[model samples]
Target: MQSPIHETTELEELEEFVINFRMRRLKLGFSQTDVGSVVGKLYGKALSQPTISRFEVLNLSYYKMCYLQTLLQKWLEETEDSLKHSSDLTGFYPFTTYQPIERGRLSQRSFTRAFMHNPKPTSEEFGYLAERLGMEKKVVRIWFYNR
Candidate 1:
């Protein structure tokens, strides 16, 4: 499946940024191999090297290009500093906006949302539901919480 890219007057501005980025790297005498290595390390995936190069063919969406632009900006800032230190400095917390119960409303989970809507099911009621689904009771409990 293909995604959509926006075409507008601002597209020219985006192209200019990509071209200028290529030129800046070339001026620094960095080969494609060098940039690929940097991208690979930045994403912690060796395959991401050629993947970044394929951005030309992919013509990545503006939002995706922005992610690359952010990485490239960091690359420029840290070109003289330690590269290892540039590894994923991000942190994630234990919270999610995704409500598993919503998905279960249609299917996948029934003991929670489906039963709750018509009749509040007891743990034993949920146990039978889980047995039919070939899942454990504890699994259903966690699904209830996450849902």
Candidate 2:
């Protein structure tokens, strides 16, 4: 079991941030899908609805959580600034939205083959694997990191 000290740690802070982010999102009349789309436009990477859902629930790894927190923080800052400067939210409309080319669990056969070849792939290898598997390199890297 976890201790009381653990409850007040950075993870707890992150949890609070996630809850606040959700509240702010809802107050701004945005859905998880809308956030996903906007985040893709704001940042280079596009998150899926499931990814955002998992982020809110803290189901992601600590590294991923931290990374996403940074992204979301930036997003919130920009969004708030837009709201302050503009009469409407139309200025924040995404010119291009990203949708994942592939969605679902990675194939066990391909994953096993890659794992056998190299338990820890380098950055280049991760990119290659991501392209081959139709997943983001970061997602592939996190998968290997979790393993």
> Per-residue CA lDDT of candidate 1, range 1-147, in tens?
343354554566667767777766665545454555555555553335454665434467778776777676666556534334552222110111112223334345455455567455578867776655534578866766665
lDDT of 2 by residue, 57-100 (tens): 99999999999999988988888888889856765663422223
What do the candidate models score in CA lDDT, each in turn? 0.54, 0.78
Question: What is the Cα-based lDDT of residue 142 in candidate 1?
Answer: 70
Question: TM-score: which candidate is best?
Answer: 2
| Model 2 misplacement above 4 A | 1-8, 94-147
What is the clash count for each candidate, in the order shown? 0, 0
Cα displacement (Å) at residue 23, model 1: 0.5
Q: How many backbone clashes does candidate 1 have?
A: 0
Model 2: residue 105 alpha-carbon error in angstroms:
30
lDDT of 1 at 90: 26
Q: What is the lDDT of residue 61 in candidate 2?
A: 92
